[model samples]
Target: MASTVLIFSASLIALFLFSLTGVNANAGSNVFSMQSYGARGDGLHDDTKALRDAWAAACSSAKPAVLLIPKGKKYLNRHTILSGPCKSNIVLMSNLMASPKRSDWSKETIRHWILISGVTSLTITGGGTIDGNGKIWWQNSCKTNSNLPCTEAPMALTLHACKNLKVEDLKVVNSQQIQISVEDCTDVKMSPVSITAPETSPNTDDIHITRSRDVQVMDCTIKTGDDCMSIQDRTENLHVNNMVCGPRHGISIGSLGDHNSEAHVSNVTVDNGRLYGTTNGARIKTWQGGKGSAKNIVFQNMKSAVEVSDVLFKNIRGTSASEEAIMLHCSSSVPCHGITLEYVKLTVKGGSNDVRSTCQNAEWKKSGSVSPQPCSFKN
Candidate 1:
């Protein structure tokens, strides 16, 4: 019978040449490959429905999409939300491996394991590795246990209200809390990001910016257990360049007018920093009855202890192992204003070079070398 019509016409021309080599879609070359939307990337299954079906086919593709999580594999997202303004421009690259100990976390699905919200134009680059297995959530911290339930330990990656954001490089490790939380975002730009944890790993803060603005935090290399970078309370126009803070708690701007509230941080700048074995070198901390105003603050190289003020501490040197090496703790009624101390050198460890500095109602002025000396903020 004509050889059964030439074997069903050669199996319909080999299934039409395998759909022309499959999945390029060919409109603007949309590619939604999370292992072809099934992802058994072998970091232990449950690849979050193959990363939520490749983020809904590259977010409802109108083209210019590429949602690939390829490269040695490790996709195990929990509280996922890669929602975006996607009809164009998206290239979420990954090797994301943070599974919150493979499920069973309460309190709203463990807070925020990965929430990339309301995006406009996003670019999350990858060398790959985002694991926040954080030693079983810091052994289920109550942060000291006041009858339990203190820290639910979340935040592995959060960019809420996302605008034009870009997170590059990526080697974020061990974060059970505060690994990267950029809230209410705007033109955000992070560079060569690399954050690690465990200097004790309690409140693991390696970068936590709040109520964001035209921000830029570059060349980041943090070693954490708390505040390698924690700029809080209605931030605006911040820029901190080339940082490498240490064993932890080196960089901080305001435990911010806490409970009393009403805080507003502005026009901040920290240039070329490198603090090691830190405890406090350059600092300003407020909270006596906060209202608003931490103006044009600046830190040239290294240090901090925290508060909010009009700071300009140039060429700041470091070395503080506690007991006042330099702690300009201000705020009786918002007193720290335009406090500029140039070429200040700090030194105090294992006590007694007689190194001292402790002021209240702090207000300052000292040019070139305010070494081991800076007391009177005079009540």
Candidate 2:
């Protein structure tokens, strides 16, 4: 009896050890070991097949699929499309290298190296770099010399129609267009994202969220050419917090247009942000004849350096053309309401008005002032 008891205890211990080993194997850094399916780690080899196979294997198991790029350099000559009805989380973790340029912008065609579309419950978290290798593309735009229709093209990371998405701890630099774009997505969270683009790079808005709902963007540093963050067309339940924006227009809502699709943006809050050298600190710009509404929006605890206005509303119809910062150029059909500003401090180095709003039923009540404004300005 004593020998049998001892034997049972030993068997249990062995079983536990085996289970631990299996877990470690499955959780092993999911590192991309090769450029192809069978090859070893040679930077020159194309490891796309290896990455796909690893993801397939992890997906088959009920575990998170981590497509680790490791520490070195991996090149992608073509677009990586992440289309999903995936059961497990897909992660692209790596210090990826941009594809080599063939020629000038004429032959430059690397669109969306990391494209995540039609996915759900995906989290892209890593401390790595995604370089767009955008020098040649920027040169092409400069050569064309046209400004109206900005020549910059598709973005580096495009998340379209994805839900429950989380993108964090990534450094994106030198992208041809927007570094990260979230469109028609819901329940998304983007945090600790650092993006850098040349101040003169046209149409390089760091993050543009459109037609999305229940989104949160926090703890980000965005330096770009266009609006650092632009929310347009049917974005609701949005929250932006603890951000730094520079070398571009500050946070903006709309350029909402006429005859285009219309959506409501409500319950949006932006708080605890710093803006430097931006065209406008906080702005709401709508076109002359759009059929949409912006409401329940609040800006709190925002500081701007060298901003055009602390708060601006350009409602062309209600206020004088030059008097409005929150412009409501919308046709009589569309209405704008419930826009609020609270606890905002701004320093406008250039000479411009401090506050402007022109929505028909808009309300502005805050305890802040511009340097040269009169003491009795209120709305």
**Model 1, clash count?**
6
Tens-digit lDDT track for model 1 on 336-366?
6557778888776754466777777667777
TM-score of 1: 0.29
Residue 191 CA displacement from its true place in model 1, Å: 14
The ten-residue window of minimal lDDT in model 1 covers 8-17
Task: Assess candidate 2 and give its lDDT.
Answer: 0.61
Poorly placed runs, candidate 1 (over 4 Å): 1-47, 50-52, 63-87, 91-98, 102-120, 123-137, 140-174, 181-205, 208-224, 230-238, 241-248, 252-268, 271-278, 281-379
Q: After superposition, how far is residue 142 of candidate 1 from its true place, in Å?
A: 19
Q: lDDT (CA) for every model shown?
A: 0.71, 0.61
Q: Which ten residues in a row have the lowest lDDT in candidate 2?
A: 8-17
How does residue 109 of candidate 2 score in lDDT? 42
- Number of clashing residue pairs in every model? 6, 14
Q: What digit string (tens of lDDT, one per residue) describes model 2 on residues 181-298?
A: 8988989998888889888877777888888999999999988777878888889999999988776677887666645546567788988877766666677776554556888988
